[model samples]
Target: MAHFPMNHPARPIYRVLSGLIGLYILMFGVWGVVLTAGESLFARESNWALGLRTNLAFSIASVIFGAFLIIGASRRTNLGHYMNLTAGIVFLVTSILMMSLLQTEANFLNFSMSTVIVSMIFGLVLLGTGLYDKVGPPELAEAERRSRDKQISEANTP
Candidate 1:
């Protein structure tokens, strides 16, 4: 039960988002591999124009990436924030590229418009979480200031 740095305003949000996204990706990879039986997983016809080719290799890659996100979130470090940001960018870009290559049986993420939209939304959310501290609310800064003051006073009392 590791705790994030209390002073960072968006630490909690980043941790939660990263963990959720990582879980989703890990499950998705498992689904892809199990459902397709490793065959035709990478085939374009399997889904659509989505950049994700759900073969054994891709599935393993997804799991690895998901694990990275999970570990980052658990660690609650700057590295975690950057990892989330990077994952968001990658997902968004891949989905967009898939959309651009759409065909009659082609679309992003399982040949569905909904999946594409969802991916983009998730991307934006991750990006926002990652950048939240850059212009954090005044209240958060004040709270941190007060907390530090309390710690200093407590230390002096001893």
Candidate 2:
């Protein structure tokens, strides 16, 4: 029997969430770049930080990240889940740091209260989606195997 990696019950949900997050990130980056006209590529104009500055560099990075998520979702690869999990953790940590250093301007990253809130939200969503289903459902897995086997048999018949 052949293996179907994306036969998990939660695969669809995970992929949808991943795609949505990717699109959001991509749009955010594109919007920022357009608004700033690339002048703030490496500038500190925006308070967002944690290698996610509101500049061109960050925008480009965000777009790439988004693209990865989208592509991973389309391909139904486990890598997408791992990447989302990592990104969630990073964003959450960054948000916490931003909140803690609200009084100081020289914090590792310069982020505002709004930025922290947004980051936290994004982090939670990513984490939730990534951790949705570590293991595939037993019934679904069996069904998937059967379906794949049937397809293979039919293909071989012709």
Best by TM-score: 1
Model 1 lDDT tens row, 1-158: 32223336556766787688778777766666665564554444453113444545456566787787778677644676677678789879966876675564443233345556756876887665656423335687678668778988999995
Off by over 4 Å in 2: 1-8, 46-53, 107-110, 133-158
User: Against the true structure, what is each candidate's TM-score?
Assistant: 0.64, 0.64
lDDT of 2 by residue, 1-158 (tens): 43335445676787688688788877877766675564645555763433344656656766787777677566645676677778789779978976898667554333567767878988898787677524456687678778889988999995
| TM-score of candidate 1 to 2 decimals | 0.64
Looking at model 2, report the run of 10 residues with the lowest lDDT sum.
46-55
Evaluated at residue 55, the lDDT of candidate 2 is 59
State the local distance difference test value for candidate 2: 0.68
Listed per candidate, the RMSD to the true structure in angstroms reads: 9.3, 9.9
